[model samples]
Target: MKKAIKILFVEDEEALGMVVSDSLRSRGFEIDYHTDGESALQATLTNKYDILVLDVMLPKMDGFSLAREYRKVNRNTPIIFLTARSQTEDVVEGFELGGNDYLKKPFSMEELIVRVKSLIGRLLYSEESQLEECFVGNYKFNIQKQTLELNGKIKTLTYREAQVLLMLFEKRNQVLERKLVLDQLWGDDSFFNARSMDVFITRLRKYLRDDSNIQIVNIRGIGYKLLI
Candidate 1:
């Protein structure tokens, strides 16, 4: 049987929260709703959810601050920021802080539903063990374990990080289009998601820097080329 999607929804607005929760529940989602950031944080620390729907304005803590704290422990589950503010800076900050998507307030129920489904479909749960292992210069990358072994050390990677590395390895020596990476990994190719992809690429480059011959070359206007 297919499992119902679980959601952690935090909103301070009582009426709106009820409506949203009910709508999601009606659509077969398992919704755990909270009115304060503190309670929501506790809920997340104790329970697991497929996705997070967080309102920016809350009583105890705001969405951005809560997301920052939450990311310190959990980086896999996707988060969508819900805010009334439409400022580009605020949206950028949300993405920079690890939010997977952002939704402006007064959005349609259909739009919210579509965004949530998109994020759930984009979950980086697994892209591992497809080729057992790959050699990258002096490092041994174990796709299944999501680890990179260098000398005598093994460094673990987050699911998203591992997925990004796996994609690069699969497309080695070729330009992996930015749109493809952003769409496959983030569910969209928005400017915010593009920035996030750049961050991931930088991180991967740092991880593989021990090998001088390894390079993730930028294709100027296109994407990245992983050369070894």
Candidate 2:
């Protein structure tokens, strides 16, 4: 049997956290809930979680700072930012700090569950069984191990980054529409999400920079094409 999906959720509001935790537990997900960013960060560093759900405002540290620190040590774990602020700047900042998704306040438990489940489904189950290894120009990508090898150097990729790269590789030399990718990964193409996509595209470009022949070219107003 498959193991339960693990989640580390951080929220300052006691009532809300309890409700969300109870709801997720009812759905059979393993949860480690915290009320402050400092403790959350410590927990993340010591434990392995499939996904992170963090609130923006916390007692010791803010979500953005915690995410930045978390990425330094662990990039593979996916992160979702919870915030009452829906401003474009806040959303963009969250993504820039390596957030996978931004969820605004007053959200429905059902919506949050869907987002969490969707991320788990895509990040944990996508393409692991069928694709063992593939090539992107001169780089060897191992899907199961989630590593990129080139020139005797191996680098790890975050789950989202690997997913984006895989999608581009599958459509090599073909244009992948922006909205299609956004929907596939983020479940929506909102302005904030679109901006987040740009960040990931930039990251992919940097990752493939070693091979000049491999390029992810943007098709203005259309999408991106991976030219290999």
Candidate 3:
């Protein structure tokens, strides 16, 4: 039998916690749910978890502070922030502070499950076996090095940027769902991360601007298509 993935879920709402915990357990995951950031942080230090589902607003300690403390000692674990805030700055702040994803309020359990799976899939396995090099238009992408070479100029990309570029390259000429991308990279499709992703996409566009054949086209409500 496959080993159950362990998750440390931190949320203050009792009803929401019970529902999400039940749903995740039914999906073959082992969840250790906490009601506040303090307990959640304590759990992190003692128990090993594959991923962390954290609520931004928590009693005793906020999710952002908890994540920072957790990252100081264990940096590899993926963190997904759950919050009702949709502000772009807040989303950007989450990412800047080491959050891998963000989910806004009133989200469906199905969407939450999908985001969890996507984050685990990429962080734990898929990313490790990616191709060493990929071609995007006239650009030569070094996945391992996180650099792109075009017209003899090498441009280094941030970790997040590289992940976004790789996703676009894999789905070149195909529309990649915006929510999926956000979840896979940032943990949630909050308005803030959406805006942050747009910034990253723009940076990618600038890097690949020399090659007119390559374009990251936004698909309005759906997502983005990488034209190559």
Candidate 4:
């Protein structure tokens, strides 16, 4: 049997959390649930999780702050934000902070399950053994090792960051849709996951900052383009 996808879920609503947790468990997901941002962040640091489902509004830390702190240490774990706030700015802010997908409150359990499956599928497909080393501008990326080397100096990449970069490299000069990216990485295309993808993109840009010839371009409503 395939390994279960590990998830860390941080939600303050106790009733909602139980329901979602139970639903996901029934579907064979390995889940860890928490009620506050601080404890969630701490648990994330110590545990190995494939994905994170976070709520924007939480006691003690809030989802955005928790994500920001998590990024400082773990730059690649995919995060999906679930919140009742539907404001455009709030949605934008969540992406800016590193959320991979977002789902508004009162969402259906079926939709959440579909999104999770999609994200996990993308991650699994992205790392298939058939894929070989790829070049991104001046640097060469060894996907298996999650390393990028330029001029003989090597830089290690977090697993999720490498996954995103590899996908962009595979579709270089083409529009990589936002939904496709989130679906592949976080298993859903919710608002929180969209924001999380943005954060990963920013980190990729920074990693390749020295190479002026390579660029990761945002195509507005579409997705991203890796210009080499």
Clashing pairs in 2: none
Per-residue CA lDDT of model 1 for 17-111, tens digit only, reads 99999999999999999999999999988899999999999989899999989988887678999999866677767866768778888998899
Model 3 TM-score, all chains together: 0.66
lDDT of 2 by residue, 103-180 (tens): 889899888888888877776666445888899999999876668999999988766677788889889999998898
* Number of the top-ranking candidate, with lDDT as the measure: 2
Q: After superposition on all CA atoms, what RMSD does each candidate show versus the true structure? A: 3.2, 2.9, 5.2, 4.5
**Candidate 4 lDDT over residue span 1-228, tens digit each:** 989989999989899999999999998999999999999988976899998899999999999999889877765566778989877678767665656567888899888877677666655665566866877888989887778999999988766777789889878998988888776666667765576678789989999988999899999989999998
Q: All candidates' TM-scores? A: 0.79, 0.82, 0.66, 0.67
**Clash count, one per candidate:** 0, 0, 5, 16
What are the Cα lDDT values of the candidates? 0.85, 0.86, 0.84, 0.82
Query: Which of 2 and 3 is the better model by lDDT?
Result: 2
* Candidate 1 runs further than 4 Å off: 71-73, 84-98, 124-134, 142-149, 152-159
> Candidate 1's C-alpha lDDT?
0.85
lDDT of model 2 at position 28: 89
